[model samples]
Each structure stands twice: as C-alpha cells, then as structure tokens.
Target: MSALRVALADDQALVRAGLRALLERLGIEIALEADDGAALLAQLADTPVDVVLSDIRMPGVDGIHALQALRARGDATPVLLLTTFDDSELLLRAAEAGAQGFLLKDAAPEDLFDAVTRVAAGETLLQPVSTDPVRARFHFRDDRAPVDSFNPREVAILRLLAGGYSNREIARSLFLAEGTVKNYVSVILDKLGTRDRTRAVLKAITLRVI
Candidate 1:
C-alpha cells in the first residue's frame, strides 16, 4: 500500500519535529505540520491527509476545537488526539468531539505507527495504558460496553490487567491458577483481535469493557 499521508499539530516545535521524524522512519508521509489548532485547520484546507495527529491542549483553538471545526465543516478526515495527561474528562470531550483515536504524548514509536495506521484505515484507536488509570480513578461512564464477544469474566480480568497487574498477580487477585490466568489472557487477546496484553488492554478500554 502507498504510504499514508498524515498531518501533525502540536504547540511544541520539538514534539512536531520528533513526530515527523518518527513518521518518516515508518515510511509515513508528512503532508503538513502546524504549531497549533488554528494553523492546523488552515493547513487542512489545502492539504489532503489521511490522518491528523493533534495535541489536545494548545494556546488557541486546541485539538478539541479543531476537531469540532472539522466536523462542523462536514469533514470526514480521521483525527487522532494526543495529550500529555490521561485525563478522563478530556478524553470524554475528545470522544464527544469525534476524535478517531487518543494517544499519550509519550507513546512508544511502534504504538504511534500502529495508531496512525489503524486510524487511517478507519478504526477507532484508544489504548488502555493511557486511559485506564483515569477511567478507573474517575469511574468514567461505561457508555460503550464491550461487544458480546468478550465475556464478563474476561472483561474482569482485562480490567485488572489494565491496572498494571501481572499475570500471577491477576491469578491471585481473581483466585485463578496462574496457568488458567495465562490461558484467559490469551483468549482475551484473541477475542480483542490483538497480539499482546498491552494491546488487548487498550482495545478493551477503548471498547469500555474494562
């Protein structure tokens, strides 16, 4: 497939520079880069990008506003929000504003690429490690419950895992054998259509299963 075209918007020059470098390394094209949300909107007027990676907080017309403006214009371009804090309120706002994905500013390079690719391919991308703690702390509304594919017990295990518990710890906490916990984790990964625990946790969180 052709390299996906991506636009980046962040107030920090260094953050934009670093993200550009990372996207280039992954063979993703930098269609445009803007220092803030207003500039990002202006750039989008002329640039046709597959995805937009915008920081949530900006001096003016932040990511949320930008997303709102895009929706107001009836633009269907996918947007992925980036933030430094894992604030549940902020996340809910982004979701309400119609962000296609949410990610931490410090996400791993691989995770960034994965998120960009998935969002570009029309998938919603919200990872657990970034949002789980805030959701747990604030008890965010479980508006998007897990699909019927994920059973209740598996969702329980995923919630514990998202809290950073290890397999043995989850086994002890859930009163299951370590082997059984491992098997459940594998099943969770499969059901979530992810290849690893972290991704599974994230997928579950995005689905509001945890």
Candidate 2:
C-alpha cells in the first residue's frame, strides 16, 4: 500500500516539526505543512492528502473555520483537530464543524497515528478524551429527552462506536458478524435519533448512555 499522505497545520513551528518527525518515522508522508489555517487552506487547494491533522486554534482562520470552509466548498476530506487543552466546548464545536476526529497534543504517538488512519479510512474518532465534561456541559433541546435506553449488547456496541470502531472492527471485538454489527449500529442510531454515527455518539455521550 502507498504511504498515508497528511496535511499538517499548527501555529507553532516546533510542534509542527515534532509531529512531522514522528509521523515520518512511522512511514507517513507529510504532504504539506503550514503554520496557520490560511496557509493550510491555500496549500490544500492543490495538494491532495489522505488526511488533515491541524491544531484547533490558529492566528487567522483557525482549524474549525478552515474545516467549515472546506465543507462549504463541498470538500469531504477527513480532518482531525488537535489541541493542548481538554476543552469540552471546543471539542463540541469541532464536532459540530464536521471534524472527523479530535485529539490532545499529548496523545501517545500510536494513538495519534491510529486516529489519523481511522479518519482517513472514513471512521470518526474521539478517543482517549473523556466525554464526561461534554455531558456535563451539553444541554439537549427542550423537546429531546434522555430517556431512550439501549440493551446491554447495544450498549457494548455504543462503547465501541464511541471508540471510533468501524462495523468490522466492532464485529471482531464482539464476536459477531459484520452484518450483525451493522444492524446493531443502525438500531443505536435510531435509538439516539441521529442518522450520523458521530452525532449518535455525541448524543449518547450527552445522555450519559455510554
């Protein structure tokens, strides 16, 4: 397989350099590097990458704004936002802005790499970060109730979903067929009243269901 190509954007030169070195050591290509969100967007106008790893905060456009711009222009490229802070509000904003993944700056190298790979392969990841804060701060709509409940098996699947596992991976982990996992995921989404897996996971977290 070809090496994974990633566009990296961060305000700090040292942070960018460190991440570049780490990713290169893992055989991933740093397709483009930018110091800020505007430069990242400009570079990506022509450069095609498997994934985008960017810091959530920057001087100008910022990662969230850049991601919103990309989506506005119909770009579905997977984006993973990085941050040094465990700000639940910022995480919720990133998710609302269509980020495929979110990670802390101090995440283990393997966890970072895995997040990139998973988002690149069309999976949404938000692991190693506790959702407790999110649940505490997030408020559902007045009409929305946190009353829906999942069976034990479905709860297990929901946990895997929160970990960003794809159906096949969930199946393998749960000793079920991939099709069974898919059906379970469908039911989970229905129970959460969301069609998107990321939203479902977020809703589940907000409900303290998982």
Candidate 3:
C-alpha cells in the first residue's frame, strides 16, 4: 500500500517538527506543513493529502475555523485536531465542526498515528480524551425532546460507536450486514436526539449510557 500523505498544521514550530519526525519514522509522508490554519488551508488549495493533523488552537483561523471552512467548501477530508488542553467546550466545538478526531498533543506517538489512520479510513475518533469533562460541562436543556431508551443490541452498538468504530467495522464485529449497521446507527442517533455519530456519542456519554 502507498504511504499515507498528511497535512500538518500548528503554530508552534517545535511541535510541528516533533510531529513530523515521528510521522516520518512511521513511514507516513508529510504532504504539507503550515504554521497556522490560514496557511494550512492555502496550502491545501494546491496540495491534496490523505489526512490533516492540526492543533485546535492557533493564531488565525484556528483548527475549528479551518475545519468549518473545509466543510463549507465541500471538502470531506478527515481532520484530526490536536490540543494541549483538554477543555470540554473545545472538544464539543471540534465535534460540532465536523472534526473526525480530537487528541491531546501529549498523546503517545502510537495513539496519534492510530487516530490519523482511523480517521483517514473514515472512522470518527473521540476516545483519546475522557468524556467526564464533557458530561460535567454539558448543559442539558429541559425543553429538548426526551431521548428514547435503546434496546440491548442498540446499547452494544452505542458502545462500539463510543469506541470510534465505523459502520462497516461495527457490522463486521457484530456479524451483521453493512446496511443493517447503518439502520442501527440511524436508530441510535434518533434515540439520542443527535444528528451525527459524534454528537450521538457525546450525548451517550453525557447520559452515561455508554
């Protein structure tokens, strides 16, 4: 297989250098590097990559804004936001902004590599950081529609979702058809009153259902 080409963006030069070394050691190719989100986007306009590894906070455009812009332009490229802080609000914002994964800058190299690979393969990754902070800071609105109870099988699927498994992966693990897994995911999202898998996982965590 060809090496995974990645675009890396961070404000700190040292951090970017360290990450580049680690990724290169793992045989991953760095297609482009940028000091901030704006540069990252500008470079991406000319360079295509398999994945994007970026810091969530930066001087201009930041990771969240960069990701929003990418999605707005119909770019579905998987993005993994890295951060030094474990701020719950930022995590939620990243998820809402269409980030494929969120990881701390201090994450192990293997963990970082795994996150990139998984996101590149179309999996939503949110397991590196604990969800307790999210649950604590999540404001539950009383006016929101009540969530439906999930069956045992659905709960099992929720667990897999929390682990960042894609529908096809979950289907294979549960010995179900891919289409069936998609249906279960739809049901889970409905039960959680969420519009996306990441939001569903966050809600599930907030509800302590997974």
Alpha-carbon TM-score of each model against the true structure: 0.65, 0.92, 0.85
Q: Best candidate, TM-score-wise?
A: 2
List residue ranges in candidate 2 displaced over 4 A: 141-148
Question: Which pairs clash in the backbone of model 2?
Answer: none
Instruction: Please tell me which model should have the higher TM-score, number 1 or number 2.
Output: 2
- Candidate 2, 1-210: lDDT as tens digits: 999999999999999999999999988999999998889888999999999999998999999999998888888899999976656677778888899998889989998888888899999987744687767766778324544467889989988988989999999999999999999888888877798998888778888787
What lDDT score belongs to each candidate, Candidate 1 first? Answer: 0.79, 0.87, 0.86
By TM-score rank, best first, the candidates go: 2, 3, 1
Answer with 2 or 3, whichever has the higher TM-score: 2
lDDT of 3 by residue, 45-121 (tens): 99999999999989979999999999999888999999766466777787878889988878888988888899899
State the lDDT of candidate 1 residue by residue for 53-152, as single tens digits.
9998999899999999999998889999997664666776776577877888888999899888877876665543356554453332443544677777
Give the C-alpha miss distance for residue 205 in model 2, angstroms: 1.6
Each model's Cα RMSD: 8.6, 1.9, 2.6
The segments of candidate 3 whose C-alpha lies over 4 angstroms from its true place after superposition are 128-133, 136-148, 171-180
**Model 1, C-alpha of 100: deviation from truth (Å):** 1.0
Stronger candidate by lDDT (2 vs 3): 2
